[model samples]
Target: MTTESSDARPLPTLTRRSGDDLRCSIARTLQVLGDRWTILIVREGFRGHTRFSDFRRVLGIPTDILTSRLSSLVEAGVLERRGYREPGARERFDYHLTAAGDALLPVLGALAEWGNEYRPSGHGPSRLYQHAETGEATSIAFVTAAGAVVPLTDIAIVPGPGENDPGVGPTHPLAAHH
Candidate 1:
């Protein structure tokens, strides 16, 4: 005998909460990616960094912090240590981004665009990107499938009524009084 679709299995339960204070999805996502170095490593990894020294040289990250960040990223599945080698100059190994890590480029693009607008000038960017053809700033934007620019207001925050809903929750600072 065959069981019905919904009857075949029950929804898996949450065996543990993330932490005492952080309970939301955004919080959980941030818990993994929120490290200051994670996104930078991701950005550099996208630019084709596959070794420890390469990340070190590009980011100028402190050795201790960089070590922690790399380990965290590997555990988070954002990177994978593909092989072990001792080039006679080293005793350990190098790391590479998995396909999962390569998929974070859009997030980095969004962040870069936001920073370009909000971050103050004179606070030099460690590096910059330019168009190969014209050699001008590489401005990032979001476009739809048919190639139309998507505006920020077009984005919506949809949270069902259960866990959290800001619309009906405590008023935000920007919220208008009713």
Candidate 2:
């Protein structure tokens, strides 16, 4: 199920199951932000939580668990640490989302959409993303290269030049529905 890549150098002969873990982008993304608490912490970041106490209080998360998740987020380049102190206080670190972390907005939006759509708990949207200028609620969607928004059935799975196995992605457990 290999495809030909037109690159001068060969890409890694890898899959999601690769030992070095450089294969599937999704797998690597999960490795960085795989856990529930980790994702929640990232969500809190998007919600403007920077201080450790803010996350702990808002999420009702323990100090040690919040600390570990913040460390992991920083290590994964999803968040950056900044030192802050009051005039008479000792310095402490605050976590802010890096560019990589900012890129996760859509992922979180998609997850929120899914929860709102399928797992409704009789509540409305927890929060809404609004256009800063227009104040219109924003939503995530699949857009084509032609700039057309299309439905899932319109999308297709094909081998990319670097794809090691066409069978792997299309039939993957997560993507199987789509």
lDDT of each: 0.66, 0.77
> Which candidate leads the pack in TM-score?
2
> Candidate 1 has which clashing residue pairs, if any?
none
Error of 2 at 162 (Å): 4.0
lDDT of 1: 0.66
Please write out the lDDT profile of model 1 over residues 25-50, one tens digit for every residue: 45544655786787888888878887
What are the RMSD figures for all models against the true structure? 8.1, 6.4
Question: How do all models score by TM-score?
Answer: 0.62, 0.80
**Candidate 2: which pairs clash?**
none
- Clashes in predicted model 2: 0
